[model samples]
Target: MKSPIAIRRGAVAAVFIDLQEEHRQDQRYLVDGYEKILANVQRLQAAARASGVPLHHWAYIVDLGAQDRPFHPVEADGKSAFSDKDDPLTAICHEVAPADGEALRIKAEASAFRSGPAAGELKARGIEWLVVAGVWTEACIDATVRDAVASGFRVLLVKDACGSGSAAMHQTAILNLANRLYGGAVTDTDGACRLLSGESVTVWQVEGSVPLRFTYENAARLYAEL
Candidate 1:
């Protein structure tokens, strides 16, 4: 079968489920961080879009059958609390609505390729590289990286574009994954863009990872209408 093509600005996204009132006060809230999560993802989407990056090409992993979860979901304050109106990751995918020619993957598990159509879709598209960005970095991100690498795809984890239950969790996840899974291929949203397109990198570079200590200040202005 064919595989996903090699593209710097390929299918990427803030792969997470929408948080509803039920999401919190329950185990799900642990992964849903209300406005913080949405804001961060929106920023990521806007940044990617301004860069002439195709939102449709950005594959968002949603839990269509998530009666249960095996990942992390946190609040904006870095709290692992659920919320109300948690949007399904697929809604974001449909938001872009890729052309029939493009491909998208639906998953019910933490890892995008752990147990769903991601593997097959990726294979058929011959996807050699994936610029992954999303929330709950510790759980879903970790699992996705493990699976993607095992399946033979170069994984570029977008640090800033992803978050976790807390700062500690986020940082720890980045360190572990970069060292263990990606061998230091981890980068922030800006760094990911620079690496992918070799243009302007807005986020600070700390050992080639996110949680940046520096930022391009003019990053937004750099690509005002990108």
Candidate 2:
């Protein structure tokens, strides 16, 4: 995988999938914290625009299975009890504009990298790096990152722009990722932008929120012939 040493005026772009009314309400509200991610999505949108990136270069709301069945909450004890009919998830797609050249792809699955036009689009443009954000940090976001890596694209998960039904799942998702497991890494929104901008830093310097760096030894142990 290749790294983005610096974000040019129009080279690197951020893609966010904002969950809306029906889609959010789907999945039995298992991915309950959709509202938590909106602000960061908006922030990233503004940043991408300021960086002169195109609208297609940014956000997408999952609209597949829309108008079919709405996501409904379930009583299951686990977080996956919710059912989304593309209802709540697509409801909160960012309000933005795009001309014909930009692409807003809809798909049948959670991870855009798996199918739809996302992979082909990225490859066609020679874009090999992705900065990802969305709800269900451990679900769709997590799935997409894994697929992207296997597809040969580098993924940087933006912490603040992603959320789960609770804090536990969110933190656990990040911890589970590190370099040790998913071959992916985590960073906050701003820090990711800085790194792509050639700021030359890994984890942020802040005290309470340093990203846990997974060592080569840790990765080796975790992935050892289990």
Each candidate's clash count: 30, 23
Candidate 1 local lDDT, 1-226, one digit each (tens): 1112223445432233222222223454344343454454455555555555543232333332344444557457543333212444224323333345434444445677777665566657555666666656777678877888887776656665566666566666665566554322555555555544535343321243333222245333322211
**TM-score for candidate 2:** 0.65
lDDT by candidate, in order shown: 0.49, 0.54
Model 2 CA lDDT for position 223: 22
What's the true lDDT of residue 197 in model 2?
47
Clashes of 1: 30
TM-score, per-candidate, Cα-based: 0.54, 0.65
